[model samples]
Every structure is written in C-alpha cells, then in structure tokens.
Target: MKARNRTIQLVILAVIALIGLFTIVSNLSAGPAKYPQVGDKAPDFALAGLDGATHKLSELKGKTVILNFWGTYCEPCKREMPALQRQYDKWKAQGVEYVGSNIGENAITVRGFLDQYKLTLPVWLDQDQAVRKQYGVSEYPTTFFIAPDGRIAKKQVGEMNDAFIESALAELVKK
Candidate 1:
C-alpha cells in the first residue's frame, strides 16, 4: 500500500514536470517580438497631445514625419531637443511634421519641460507607454524618420545632432 502511494506521488510530480517543460518549450518556440526596422512600415498609433489634440501616425501619411520618443528624465533626450527644434524650424515651412512622443509622463511635467526648453514642436503624451512599446523604443531618445509614403527611412536610436537630423530629413524627403 505504501509503495502504491509513493508510485502515485511520483507520477503526479512527473506530470507537473512535463507540463512545465511543455510550457517552456512553447514559449521558446514563439521567439522574440519583431520591431519595426528601416524599410518597414512605421507602426501607427493615435495618442493625445498636451493641447488635447489626438495625433494619428496614419493621418500624417502625406508628410515626412519625424517620430521622436523621449522622456524628460533622460539627459540625452533633453540635449537633443534643441537640435530637434532647430531642425523643425528649418523644415516646418516645407510641411515636415516633427512629433515628439513623450513616454510615460504627465501633461504638467511634459508641459513644464517644453516651456523650460522653449520648444514649440508638437508634443504627444504616451501616458501608458503603449506607443513607445509599439515603436520598440528601448532607449530614451529613439527617432524614426518616416517618409511621405509611411515607410521608415531611418531609425536613430540615440541622441541626434543637427547634422544627423538634417541628413535624415534629406534622406526622408528624397523618397
């Protein structure tokens, strides 16, 4: 009787181990999620701005769009804002849309940062960071240069300078 009980316990443990192994195998087989790369279609998202305006990526299809994912706490993101502003100023007249997507921040905080920087570029708040994750923004300042046709021309993963921004814009518009 004791031997039979031990045998049953061993069988139950083996069943649980098999289930765990199956789950692990299934997850491993699923592989990693794919992020948007250069030449891929930019993932579209509709997020609200500080002014209470909803900006949709698909709606800006006809214009070259610069999607900048940033956070107020990141020094590199702050450092690149002026360069972005300069580029925006240079290209705004030509219908270039620079969308600054603030990741996981409140309106007051973002508004204060913008005011402090004196940046007038259109700012969108990703309060839940859904848009940031959709864009696969692992870093603080990841900039995606989307061409007029809605294709990603370049993915700048760090702080950008005026020259790099200009070159990216030039390449984006060339499409």
Candidate 2:
C-alpha cells in the first residue's frame, strides 16, 4: 500500500511538470507581440474629454495630428506642456490638431492639471489606458506625429521642445 501511494504521488508530480513545460513551450513558440511602429497607420481610438465630450482619432483624418500621451505625475510631461500649447496655438488654424491624451487619469485630475498649467490645448481623457496601449506608449510624454494621411510620421518618446515639435510638424507637412 505504501509503494502504491508513492507511485501515485510521483505520477501526479510528473503530470504537473509536463503541463508546466508544455505551457512554457507554447508561449515561447508564439513569439513577441507587435507594437505600433513609425510608418504604420495610426491606430484609431475614441475617448472622452474632461468636458464630457467624445473625440475620435478618425474624425481628425486629413489633418496633421499630434497625439501627446502624458500623465499628471510625469515631471517631464509637465515641463513640455507650455511648448506644446504654444505650438498648438500657432498651428491650430493651419489644419494641425494637437491633442493631449491624458493617460489613466480622471476628469477631475486632468481638469486640475490643465488649470494649474493654464493650458488651453484640447485634451482627451484615456481613463482605461486603452488608447495608450494601442499607441504603444511605454514612456511618459510619448508624442506621435501623425501625418495628414493618417500614417505615423514620427514617434517621439519622452519630453519634446518647441524646435523638435516644429520640425516634426514640418516633416509631416512635407510628406
């Protein structure tokens, strides 16, 4: 009886080990997942604004769209807001849409941040971070310069300056 019990336990352990091995092997075979890259079609997303209005990325097709993914906690992002606002003011009338995609933040928090910064740029609230994930934004202040044709012209990760933003806009317009 003792021998039989030991055998049963060994069999169960072997089965569990085999299952774990199989799972690992299957996952390894699946390969790395793909993220958005430059030259890819900008993924479309619809998110609400702080004012309770829904904005869709597709609606801005045929316009140069600057999608800045930012969070309230990121200092670099905070530092770049004024430059973005300046560029937005300068180019908004020229069919350029600069949108701040506030990642994983509530309307109240976003509202407070905007008020503190005195920023008037249009901001979309990405409450669930779905838009961020879609855009492959792994860092704070990842800016995507999408061309008028909806292709990603450039993916600027981290904070951006006025010159960089202006040059990117120029490139988008040239293409």
TM-score of each: 0.81, 0.80
Tens-digit per-residue lDDT, 63-168, candidate 1: 9999999999999999999999999999888779999999989899998988998989889999899988887889889999988989998888899999999988
Tens digits of lDDT, candidate 2, 1-175: 9999999999999999999999999999789766778999998889998768898999999999999999889999999999999988888888899889998888888888889889888889898998888777889989988999999889988889999999988777766
CA deviation > 4 Å runs, candidate 2? 1-31
Computed on alpha carbons, the lDDT of every model, listed in order, comes to 0.90, 0.89
TM-score, prediction 2: 0.80
RMSD of 2: 8.6
Give the Å shift of residue 10 in candidate 1. 47
lDDT, residue 151, candidate 1: 90
What clash count goes with each model? 0, 0
Residue 85 CA displacement from its true place in model 2, Å: 0.2
